[model samples]
Target chain A: MARIVGSIMSTHVPSIAGAMSRHAEGEPYWKPFFDGYEPVRAWLDEVRPDVAVVVHNDHGLNFFLDKMPTFAVGCAPQYLHADEGWGIPEVEPFPGDPQLSWHLVESLIGEEFDLTTCQEMLVDHAVTNPMQLCWPDPDDRAAIRIVPVTVNTVMFPYPSARRCYALGEAIGRAITSYDAEEDLKVVLMGTGGLSHQLEGRRAGFINKEFDLRFLESLTEEPAWATQYSGEDLVRLTGSQGVELLMWLTARAALLGGARKVTSNYHIPISNTAAGTVVLEPAA
Target chain B: MGTGTTRHEIPGTTIFDGAEAQKGYALNKMCFSFNDGTNRAAFLDDEEAYCHRYGLSDDQTKAIRDRDVLRLLELGGHPYYLAKFAGIFRLDVQDLGALQTGLSKEEFQARLVAAGR
Candidate 1:
């Protein structure tokens, strides 16, 4: 069976990519956010999972309001990042595991989660930013293919906290049952949130207190998150912060328990609070 | 938690639900097309013609012409997609927020900094 060795939760902000390309090593404004990802990069090297399942939301790049799916998984053999206007520096395509992708698609549907299967997609920075943060060096990209599981955070009815956690439970089951013969190490990722409203009068709002508590609960009392309502999330978190449902889904996949290996939180990475926490199954 | 058909009534924000989705389809589609650089340039070259090409309603066309962020939101223009439309006018999110909240650009930026506190 494929072993879900670990998981990562992060804020996939687009400006972080600009900071990276500009080599903001010594710049005070950018260094903290970049520094925050340092340990995350080290952890990726240490665990070196064979593949990563990226859970993220598309920001009007791949899916517009026309036909946004509540949940979609990239089934292509290779996924490329698209130019999301204003020329965010491009990167090489992320390798994908099509066979494993199809397996999960069939299995998840059987598990009663009908996910839209995408054969071709231009992944936006919502997924790529966190990917680059975890795996900074190109040399490290080898051996770690990606399977993108995108959620609809742009429009509602987003997958609820309960449904998200349940999706993770389903993912945990799917990974264990598939490819029992192969010795595969998998890393699951859920990216987005930690508060900060992007639109309306309350733009740039961040809840550090609520955000930190969420990190604590995500690692310790994940089941408690299921009770969060749309209003509760919107009231506490920003409108965009509701995207934390993505993390709950990933946390649910780990099932029983996990230990947070690293945690990083920084304020206002271009109008959003940025955070990352790496978890490994408890010993 | 169902399909985004649920109605939400936030004090100052439009939820971009099914009804707004229908209302803003043409305008949003036009904005979404700005992902392609060529479309962005074409829209810049002749915005009125471009709006008409997409069959946008008079309100949406007026909103685009006026660079009115709040009006666009009221007309069902999604903030994320409308951002592309705003980008054509070189207005960033902070600038747009400045317009909606009646703050100067500098004041809006200051408020953003204060929000992190």
Candidate 2:
């Protein structure tokens, strides 16, 4: 059986990669955002999980409008990175855990969640940025394997909060039930959100009040957000702010009450109200 | 299950719904192609011919030519895909936000910083 380490929810803003490429974390403009990750990095060092199950949304790197899957799970042996239109430099490919991936795919489908399985998936910044944020050193990043579970946030008719939460629950069950002979420690990650829209006249929209409350709800009332529809979330948060759905799904995967170990909320990280939270399930 | 009948309007924002997706297929498909460097270079070489090859609507072609962020959005462009189009000119989200809001880049950035306070 696999042991759950905890869950980490982060905002996967692409500009972070640009700043990182320039080695600008110490610069005044980026210091505050960069400092927030120190505690998380320390925690990761302590837990030292062997595998990370990343729950994120793709921003037009892998799947285009031609055929969008509502929920897709990567079962590949390795995942590569590509140019995401912007000039952000691509990172090294991340190793994957195919054995665990197949078990998850089997368990999730048995639990009645039909998911599109990908043998080869190209992850965009949404997946890479968080990895870099956690493991800034290239060697540290390469040590752990990854399993990407992407939900559709690129298009409308996204999976409802309830559905995303349920998916998280199934993920928790599947991870715990894996019949591994060796002991395994797995970390779950939810990437993106904290409210900021980047389209239409409301291009610079940010709802701090809503973002703060939503962050609080993650620990106190994990299912609090499930009450709202996708439209409601977009209205309250912002078009892109709705990426908070990824956070909810990751938080729900904890499967029980959890205490917020640490959280950082900052504004204007490249058109986003950037936020990150680490939750440890109640004992 | 069919919640499309009831539309929720968020002022100053456009939801990329099924209808919007249908309308922007050609334009978005063209934008998606920009993921490849060659396609981006080709689009820059001859903008009009590129638009024709993508089967873009006259309005969409004009929107591309004018680099009108708001108009392209009105024509059903997804911000994510339009972002690829914006990259041809090296414009990031802040630039797009400034363009759509009719504000200078500095003003838009300040507004975002102020949101935290």
Best by lDDT: 2
Worst ten-residue run, lDDT, model 2 chain A?
A259-268
User: lDDT tens digits, residues B9-73, model 1?
Assistant: 66555565677777888988998998888998998899899999999999989989998878888
DockQ of predicted candidate 1:
0.50
Stretches of candidate 1 exceeding 4 Å from the true structure: B1-8
TM-score on alpha carbons, each prediction: 0.94, 0.98
What digit string (tens of lDDT, one per residue) describes model 2 on residues A130-158?
A: 99999999899899999999999888899
lDDT of 2 by residue, B2-112 (tens): 335678678999888888888999999999999999999999999999999999999999999999989999898999999999998999899999988999999999999
Winner by DockQ: 2
TM-score, chain A only, candidate 1, equals: 0.96
DockQ of each: 0.50, 0.85
Give model 2 RMSD, 1 decimal.
1.5
Candidate 1 on A51-138: residue-level lDDT in tens?
A: 8988888988889886899889899999988767556788888999988888889889998997999998778887788888887776
Candidate 1: clashing pairs of residues = A1-A180, A156-B4, A157-B4
